[model samples]
Target chain A: MMCYIYDGSFEGLLTAIYETYYRKEHPNKILSITDYEKSFLYKDVFIDTDPNKSDKVYNSIKTKISNQTLKHVFHAFVSENEDSGTWIYNYLRLGWKVGKKLDLHLTDDRVLAIHNITRKVSREIHYMQGLLRFRKIKNDVFYAPFEPQFNIVGLLASHFANRMSDQNWIIHDVKRDIGVLYNQEEWVITNINLKGDITFAEDEEFYQKLWKEYFKNIAIKNRINPKLQKSNMPMKYWKYLIEKN
Target chain B: MEILDKLKILADAAKYDVSCSSSGSSRKNKKGGLGNSHISGICHSWSDDGRCISLLKILFTNYCIYDCAYCVNRSSNDIPRAMFSPEEMVNLTVNFYRRNYIEGLFLSSAIYKSPSYTMELLLKTVKTLREKNFNGYIHLKAIPGADLNIMREAGKHVDRMSVNIELPSNNGLKLLAPQKSKEHIIKPMGLISSKIVENVSERKLYKNSDKFVPAGQSTQLIVGATPDKDLNILTLSESLYERFNLKRVYYSAYVPVSKHPNLPQISTPPLLREHRLYQADWLLRFYGFKSQELLDSKNPNFDIHFDPKCNWAIRNLHLFPVEINRADYEMLLRIPGIGIKSAKKIISARRVGPINYDNLKKIGAVLKRAKYFITCQGKYYGETKFNEDNIKNSLLANSSDKLNITQGEQLSLFSLYPNLLPLPDILTKITGEL
Candidate 1:
């Protein structure tokens, strides 16, 4: 049995995928370097990431299969699920045969696996877009820190970049120890380790107090349903919510 | 008063006006704008009532000149009064918006001094937001009896506008809110509708033309406040959708906040009835069901035991046993427990291959109720006979465990029956889809 392993970066995974197609080898598992364990039973192949090979694979997925399929593969890769690499490999192999009709084959198990993972990632992206609370910090930069289940800081930053075009902002995925730093012009995802307490700007407490007051008063006393509130805004997300605190 | 005290009073007063959606507008970010509106709305948080906290829903003021019997802020009731200056309101919106506490502002107001005066105040606040390049979603209230020119100008500055037709029936309006006339409310709605139509065509001719209420308009109707039946309300809603082309009609259950001779002396809000109305409203908008078909003179209210679609399907059993694969999208939508989402999935899945019972479930169809109404490849899955009574009993047995209603008790022959079933109170939480 052969096992393919690469660095956890998206481009490294794409490069490994290109090699599998080029070499015509069906590996048992495709894993990231961090997730890979040393095994004597299977021959391990460490893939070196080549930008040219990865770009070829990226363009082929876009031009041959579909743009949406590319999005699925990228999102599923970033989901950080252990089996996601194998799922994306199988999905793209099938997608290469079916072309743009790949998503329509929802009944196929290989397609369904990718579909479910992408859906989970996209759901987190949508939720983080709304639930992320930004605190005004020193130098007028709006800083929002969240511990989302999926590694979706890049997607969330893009959404906010368009919505808040004039302001400088940073969205930190605290769990992953990475963040997207956005100036007025553009955004870039980079490794960031934030420690200690963040100092908030002046009047931050005033607005937060007002928001808490509004959140408290807006609920009808007669229609208080804590169960419903918990379901919609689950306990996992309450750690950083200003109103929940 | 300080901003903290004023926010508490104004937000408490504004809680009853439940038009909670921040959707339908796609105002993009400008070169140097503070915010932009998403095409699909986002909910920031859910309150204790499980309602979406999409916007910073607050009233410009709690002071009112008119005394409406159903209102907490009515003049006769001496509630704590407060108001926000235009600059104060703008600052709160910008600061709240920057901190991601809200999508935008929902600036509603009680009739302070006069309708025109209140309308001008709303216009001023939104105009300042626009001037600051704040492109966030703004849902402004159009004060009835306000000057047309001011309201028209206000429409250009906000993403959406709404006028609450508080009572469904004109008689209910006259008896409870005597100060408000039917024409005063309807006139602004009519004007906004026409202006939206005008804006659409103008933008088509000139791409850079100014947008008027780009998210369109919506309205709220208070349920259980007056003796208005579901039929009247649904009919009014249908016409509002057809004639005015409004985006949505929100139904807020009367919470019994005030004491009045005209109001029902109920301790609790009629949440179940409100839930049924919302279900029926969904049928009208998406399921291709009509107001007349859902109810008539013979049956004016929904059955408390079953949802509207299930109740309608049981009443008309002849339409059941619909072939799952062969049925068109419209017929698929009429089946019980098959929502618009599931119906669309079935259609798309059919193109790939023939679907079985398992495939239907995987497609997100609620087969618990749909199993009775549909057939898979010429075989019916329902255990009971195809007759209305058998299927109805089976469905009752299925739902009675959840609702805690007595299983075998016969429904009363009288039309106006009490809410015997004690469904959970969370059922009244207004879903964001509406």
Candidate 2:
């Protein structure tokens, strides 16, 4: 059985799919570089990153299937789940067979699994848009540090660009070590490290105190349900939140 | 005074007024504007009580002129007082919005000096936010008896405005809040409703005329405070929605903060009762159930054990055993535990072919409760016959109690065990009756 190995990038994964169709040979499984296995009987076919092949697959999906379907597949790719490769493969396979209306078949497990991952990623992005608290730094640029469970650092750029159009801001995902920096005109992605001696705005402490006070006082003491708070705002995001901190 | 102290006092005073919706409008951010309103709204945080903290809910002041027996901020009560200037309010809103800490501002105020005076301050704050090009959502409370012109002008700059009818009945208002009258409250609501209608027709012709409360209006009714039954409250809400074209009717379970003679003899707010009222209200708004349909004169209040939809479905059991694949959207909605989302899913899925029990589960329908009311193609999967007590006991047996309702008179609000009742879960999901 042949095992197709890609470079752990979305484009590389697409190129592998292109090769599977081009060679008319089905692999036993598709895997990324990090999850490589060494064995006796497994034939390893390394997939080189080809932009032309990836673009062909991308355009074919937008034309042959649906653009909305492509978005769901891309969102599931960034979900970084262990079952993502197989489920997305099955989803695309079913999507191509059912034409544009594949999304309506909720009974299909592959389609259901892909939608679930897409929901998780989108939910995380939406929650981050609310939970991310920005603090002004020395250069008058706003910086927020968070550690989301999913790799959605690049997904939040367009939302903040539309909302905070007048200010320069940075949203840093500490776990992945990458961040998006926006300067009102455009946004750039870079690997940023800020655990060392990050400076704050002069009145940053004062605002933080006020926000904590508001969060505490807004709760009805007669109706204190700590379990509910924990369910909505889980403890994983607590250390980065201003009030939870 | 320090800003932290002011926030503590104002936010503490404002906690009892439970209207935390940040939805209904989709105002885009102008090129120079600082923020925009999302169509379905966004929730920033959840308080310890499981209530959503969407907007920056705070009163402009805690000082008041009227003495209401049930209120903590009445003239007789000696609570610490603080107020924010219009400019300070604008600054706080803009900064918090930029930091993504809130959806917008929910600015309510006490009647300092007079109702008009308090409304003028709220109007100034919202107008300044608009003039400064901060396009975030703002839900301003229109003080009853405020000048009509000032209220209309305030509506121009804000997304939503609510004139709370705190007490449902006239006698309750007279006994508890002698300074307030039912007539004074409804006057502003009527005017705002007419103005909203006028603005819609005018904008249709004029194209770019400034919007007047583009998200429309809503009001709140404090439940469990007086002896009014759920039927009276639901009937009033039904009329409000029909007469005023109201966007929503919020039900805040009365949290007993003051010791008063006229109030009910309860130490804790009736959480289950309040939850039941919200469930019935959802049926009225979304499920197309009328006030008379959910309850009758024989039973003025909703059933404490079962939800309103479940109760109604059980009573009309002849309509049950509906074929999931063949049922129309409205017929599917009548089945217990099937919400608008799952109903739409069933409709779309059936178009491809026949559906079965596994497909129903995949569509996110609450199969435990829906099983008793529906059949898949030709076969029924329900355990109990068409009987009320049997279905109710089975539903209770199946649920894991999402809410922490407990037993006895102490009525602890912090219990983790779920007799489990908070219908619709969140306030903004009021459109989804399930």
Candidate 3:
């Protein structure tokens, strides 16, 4: 009975998985250091994040099990679910035994657990890609502030980078206090804080007013269903949406 | 007029044209490009009426030369008119795209001077967006009777082009819209359809050949406007998909905005019927069901209680109780509750091991609807006996009444402003169908 703990970073989780294999210890639980609580039932082992070890495990999963399973692991890590660490650890344990045929075993509870979390993460990414409303701020930069359920700021960088290739933009995850900043050519994720005071560029309020007006008139007044609207764009996401606000 | 006033009148006028999808084109961003098109189409917002606002759907102008009885923008109607200059349209599209407020522009218009002249302005707007290195999705409405050379040239600049065949049947068209001949509408559709076919082969030969309507063509048909049956609409849509290779056919419920002698005087839009038609459309495109299979001369309308697939399955009870593990992919799709995603999951899961009743749910099968139609591991899980009436009753007992036909009628436009409605001749349009 061993409990493995690592830092909250994705690389740290992979390094923890590597330790379980190298030390030949069966993990009773795998958790991040932030999620760990004192328990007398098992001995805790703090696994330090080593890039070399993490890369080795990452490449092995891509080659041994399948590239798709590797993506599932990464997405599960990004989901930030409380039990995601344990689920990914168990899923990989089974995936290592079955090799490339692991994803076909959908009925397996561990595989299903990992698959479900990955779906949640990807679904949030897709939703945020659409729901993120950018406001023009100083310096002709497009700034969007959102509070997504999952840590998906990094995942959205490449998408917006390719879509808005000629403009400078910043996608801020307000809850996480991190942003993906994109120049004309490339993007990088870094810590940022707006402190809730954002100066709108000239004509920004005009366009926002126009958008709100368009939103109101575009709906078929004959078919006003708040339930359907709430289902598609939930109430929680209305905090930062320009039209909703 | 100010831009704000123009946007309001134009967007309000264009709301009835209900094709807002910005999908199917994967135009990549070139060097120094401002935007790119998403293949799956991203919806930026849902309007209060619960429809997706993907593209910035608006009309180039709301002025028309021909009067149509079913249209709000009929030349005879006393509505506010507005038009966007080519530069104004280009500015709105770029700013909206940059702000992530929309995927692209769904540019439609009422015919102003003439068809060819109107199309030329629409073409100029899209061309300016392209010249500015904007790679975002652009859906341009091809004015029917527009010159073929202008329409063909417009196709090369836009992602998709559509000429609305608003009325489903030619007879309906003649009676409701006297000016629009069926030939005038079909001619442009045929030209655009053939050019899209030509572009496919040309692209194969020269990779750099510009794509023509790369997202493919789509059209909208207003339901409940005329006395056209679901059979006529479905059959017409089937031919459009087969002949023109249309990517989609949108069905909008007729929202009564004008009092016309030929149009129906319904108090509310037939939302439930429109929903059922869309469901049936999905079946024809993806579920492999033909129009003739869903309806016959005896039954020209869908059941108000059951969906098209469930209704079909009940009438043909011999096809029920399909063995889940042994059923082919197409047969799995034929079952009431199994969809394309679930069918694919079943096939992939069966390769690993045989599926049972428990695994069917995790594979995404809706057991409440599928239980009566399938058997897992040779075991039946349905509550009722293996008969048509029993199965339908059991299914009905478990179903929710959310999509009741009588719903959505209480909140009518006439209900809000009682003084504005013409109530005396309401009986002139009720055939008691649908």
Candidate 4:
């Protein structure tokens, strides 16, 4: 049995997928660089990142399958699904057979798995866009910190850029140790490490206090259903919510 | 009083207005502007009732001249009242919006000095927000009997506007809210609709000059408030949709906020009935189901046990067991478990190949309900036979699976003598859908 190992990056995974199809060698398992543990039972294949090869495979998919299918693949890769590498490989192979209508093959297990993963990633992005609370940090910058289940910093930055064009903001992904900084013009994703001790603006807590007050006052006393609230907003996201606090 | 104290009083007073959706306009951010509206609106928070807090929904002031029987802020009720100065209101809206706490403002006001007085104040607040280039979505309520000219000017600055028809019929309005008449409420609705139509055609003729009520108008009807039946309310709503070209008609379950001799003695709101009405409203808007198709004058209320769609499908069983693989989109949408999303998915998914139960579940259909109404290639896997009573029992069994498995007190009851059942069970059945 052979296990395929690649650098833990979306581009590297796509390149590894290209190699599997190019060499026609199917591996028993696919693991990211950090995911693989030292084991002697299976032969290991290390895949190097090659933009040329990745672009070739990407172009083939764009030409053969519809662009919508390719977009779904990218979103699925950003998801935290551990089996997403092999799943993408199987999905692409199926896409090659089914052409642009590959998404309609919902009965197939591999296709359905990819579809669910993409949906999950997009849903997470949408939820974070709404649920995230930004505070006025120093330098007059609006700073918000979150721990999303997917790598959605870029998506959130693009959305805020469209919505708040004249403001400077930074959305940090605490789990990924990366953040997107938008300086009232453009946004760039950078590796960011933060010190826990940080001070907010002088009137920041006042606005937050008002917000918490508004949140509490708006709820109807008779219609309090904590169960339904939990269903709409999972408890995992409560840590960053100022109102919940 | 301080703004903080006023916020608490105003927010508490505004809780009964249930038009919470912010999904209408898709106004883009102007250059150097501070905000924009997404095509699909955003919800900044959720209240305890699992309802969205999209906009900073609050009344500008609770002081009113009319003593509406159902209003908590009626003149005779003696509730704590405060008013926000136009400056204070503008500051609050901008600060909250910049903090990402709300999409925009849903500013509603009571008749302070006069309808025209309230209208001018509303116009002042929204104009200030727009002059500051706050391009966020604004849904301002139009005060009935306001000058048509001022209301139309107000429409040009905001994204969406609404004139709530608080009651279904003219008699109900006259009895509960004496100052408000059906003509007074609908006049602004007709004005807004005509201006929206004019803007559409004007934009088509010329290039562009700022639009008027670009998201169109919507109204709210208080359910369970009067003796008016669902048939009357729905037919009224259908006509509003046809005549006014309204964007939406919100149904707010009547929560008894004030005491009056005419009001019901019940303590809690009829949330399930409201849910059924919303479901029926969705059928009217998206499924192309007419109000007459869902309910008739003879049967003025929806069934308590099943949703409007399920009840319709159960009565019209000859239309089904529709072949899942071959059903048209409209026919597929008529099934109980197949929503717009699932019906569209079924159509696209079947273009690739045939689908069965497993695929149906993955494609987001509620198979527990759909199985009784649909078949995959003419094969039915439902446990019960093709009888209405049996299917109803099976559906109930699915809902109360644990109760049935534990041999709990049987819930089976024939409608032949529905009035004879115990009062507790009858109440439970009425609120069962929730």
Candidate 5:
């Protein structure tokens, strides 16, 4: 049995994948770099964090697989699947041997598992786009806070930035303590500290009033099924929705 | 009054209008326009029932002079009613747009004071949003009996407009809703259609002419309320699309709220029936299935166990085992598991090389479902029996055990006794060929 340790980052994982392919050693087990101490009497190899090796692997992936495939691999990594480390090792080994036709073996169980995880993460990212309802604060900046099931805050930035290009808005991933700030033309992801009280301008309140009215007015009393409504727009998300209040 | 109170009342009233789609238009941002509508569309929110809330669907007023029995906002109902000023609605839309909370407005209204008066308020709201706020992508509801001038003015300002053909038949309307007449609804729809055609032709000659309801028109029909079968409903919807140049035809399942002697006392909403109708509707629009082909006098409803397409394939077993290589695009679309995308893929891939079963999976065909109906080259892998009854029984047996167990239970009696079943059940018996 052989244990390989990689630096705890996406690039580090890519470098590890590169080493596994180059070494050509069919290791019985693969472990994260942080789990080095946990390796029990196995042949352990500690990989030095190499940016050049990571870049080479990324380039090879970009050339061999489509850009979409590289993105799927990255998303699979973010999914934090329990068996992903081993699966990534095998996937890369298979891709290196296949040479630019990796998707041909997508029906293989191991490849399909990775693809499924990646698809789930992608779906979560889309769901959050529709679910993330923002409120306007005093400075014409829109503010929204959410605690999504997955680390999808980074994925949602481009969607909002493109859709709400003319307006200034901030979508805060409250749990992760990071947000996407869009001002007129450009948008950037930044760390935010929102522990203190937040306030909106009088005009913001005026608009909120109108939105609240709109939300209330849209529900048909004849079809007022709170049970059904709770299923779609959960009570957990109501705190941030303007109408829920 | 404060805008919040008005929002509550209007949102509640407008919530019943089950046509919240903001798609089928590709309007771009003009030099000074605040927003634009994408053809693929954007859904701003998904409501509790897992339905997408695209536009800010709200009514201008819940105070109605016409007392439709099925409506909560009927004049007879003792509920608190409210109306939004044109200025208030425009402000709400602008503010909401700035906050990234909505795609656009889905402005609808009750018959407040008079049909003309209600139409005027709706027109003013869209006008304010377009002219004063410079907002774009508005979908206004044309009042059924409103003045043609008001409807025309509405068409000029908004992206899309709809006049609900609430009940399928005039008799259904007479029994359930007394005040609304078939002519009142159909006449305005006809006027809007002609005006849209005129605008398109005029724009061809004069390139700078203003667009009129560029998203086109859509209408909704309430299902399960009247005695109309799925055949009747689908036939009418087919005519509406063919004649009106409609962008979409939405179907809302009737949820009985009133304890009227006329209505049925049902426990759950007819969601499955509504879903089947929508599936049938899609078949009519995208797939080459006609309404008459889907249902006839002998069998006038969709199969509850399987989707309309799957049911159709099972019934017509003689048509099955179509060779994927030789099958035309339309024929490929008729296969149970092959959607438009998959059919196109098969067509494209076959041009390059002969495709087998493995290659079909690569193109995203649901092999489990398609396996029964399709052939690769000359080899047919479906059941050896190859009879309609055997194929249907096997398909139903396999499908009933899967996700649609409850639906199977609801439809079991109909599948057994087609003629003796109720109208709803009879409709569920005939499979639509989408």
Candidate 6:
């Protein structure tokens, strides 16, 4: 029984799949090098970082499966879930043998498990699209800061680009330290550092005052249930909500 | 007056309206307007109380002249009163919209000074938002007993209008809220509907006339408050829809705020009952179930355990075992657990070939409940008995256990047989259903 180890990147995982295909050696276990200390007691085979092998595997999977399927697998990898790496390895192996019809047999436990993680990530992306509260900055760029449970910064780009087509917007995911910038015409995802005091628009104080006023007015004193409200909008997410602060 | 202080007082008063939905309108920003509206309106955030906060729902004032018993803001209640000027409301709306804090405004108010004066103030707020600030997508509440001319002027600027038929029956209104009458509420709705129709007709001829209340109107009916049953409530709602051409009818479960001898002392609001009524209401609008078909004089109340559609289908077993391929759209809607989406899917899929059990699942049918109602071609996949009595007993037994879990009660034999054992005896034994 041989355990295959690769670099923690998604491309490195694809390269390991290339080796599994070429060598025809079924791996007993598949893991990332980050989990090396927790490696199982089995014969180990480390695949050296090879760009050509990674490209070949990426191209093969792209051609065999639809772009939508490849995107799901990529999202599952970036989610960094507990069993994500092994599930991707197993899903691809079965997918390659069965061809494009693998998604139809979702009753299989391994396939269903991967599908569940991808769905969670997708749902978070949809929720953030609706829940993202943007604060207007001086440069006329609308800025919003969020801390989503999953790394969904990439998924939110199209939503803002389509909805706020005529305006500039930036959604910064504070948890992952990444941001998606939409400059009216296009959008790009990049790393951002919010370490120091970040300055907002000059009109920030005025808007904040108005928003706080509106928030205070909307609550019905007759039915003030702090417990019920806390259940819907948890206290953990209140730091970013302007009204809550 | 300070706008901040007034907002706090007025918004706190307006929070109990429970109709904060900003959906059902597709208004866009005109040349000078600051914002656009989507047909499927946005819910900017969910409030802590699990309600949608799509709009900044608030009143212009909480000071009232009429003494309505059920209202917290009645003249007799010793609460602080406040009002916002039109300019203050417009500024707040524009600022909130720019910050992505709210989609639009849901402006309601208690009748301050007089009905005409309060309606004029509400109208001034919306008119300033549209004409002065170029704000888009305002949902204004029509003050009952307000002048017809004021309501007509309001229809021109706002996207939607609602005059809540608060109580179901005239007697209920007289008993709970003496100041309000049936005609006062229903008249404004009738006037608005006719004005909407007239405006639409004029637009068809002129090609550029401004839209009048493009989102139409809706009303709210408080559930479980008065002696009216589900049948009576639904019958009234049906007339409100057919006669007034209402876009929606919202049901708010009664939450007792004040200690009144007449009102029931419920520990928690009847949220589950509200949910079931919404399901039944959806059936009325999209599923083609009339009020008579859903409830009757014998069983006037909805089943507490199962949803209304499921309960209705189980009681009429003769209608069941419908062949998927041959069932018409209307008949397909009658089957339990087959929603509008699944019924449409069945129609479209069966056009190519005969549908089977596997095909039904693919079309998103809830087979756990639909199993008793439908058949794949000729083969019935449900339980063999198909008798109403047997099916009802089995369904109740299965559902009572699930209800116990949801109500945070332990599963006991006595709870499993609610009809046979007295509720007090069961409560003493298990201490559940508190």
TM-score of each: 0.96, 0.94, 0.95, 0.94, 0.79, 0.75
RMSD of model 5, in Å? Answer: 5.7
Q: What do the candidate models score in CA lDDT, each in turn?
A: 0.88, 0.83, 0.87, 0.83, 0.74, 0.75
lDDT of 6 by residue, B61-111 (tens): 888888766677878889988888888888887777766787788999988
Q: Which stretches of candidate 1 lie over 4 Å from their true place?
A: A39-43, B405-423, B429-434
Question: Top lDDT: which candidate number?
Answer: 1
Fnat for each model: 0.81, 0.72, 0.77, 0.62, 0.33, 0.38
Question: Higher-TM-score candidate among 1 and 5?
Answer: 1
Measured by TM-score, the strongest candidate is: 1
lDDT of 2 at B106: 96
Task: Please give, for residues A39-146, the per-residue lDDT of candidate 4 as tens digits.
Answer: 999999999999998898899899999898898888888885778887888898889988988988877888998998999998888788678888888888888888
When only the first chain is scored, the TM-scores of the models are 0.96, 0.95, 0.97, 0.96, 0.81, 0.83
The Cα error of candidate 6 at residue B92, in Å, is: 1.6
* Candidate 4 Cα errors over 4 Å, as ranges: A39-41, B400-434
Candidate that beats the other on lDDT, 4 or 5, i.e. the better one = 4
User: Comparing candidate 4 with candidate 6, which one achieves the higher lDDT?
Assistant: 4
lDDT tens digits, residue span B330-370, model 5:
99999998999789877766664688887688668988778
lDDT of 1 by residue, B154-250 (tens): 9999989999999999999999999999999999999999999999999999999889999999999998877778889999999999999999999
Best candidate, DockQ: 1
How big is the positional error of residue B427 in model 5, measured in Å on the Cα after superposition?
17
Worst 10 residues of 4 chain B by lDDT: B425-434
Candidate 5 C-alpha lDDT tens digits along A96-118: 67666565454455566666788
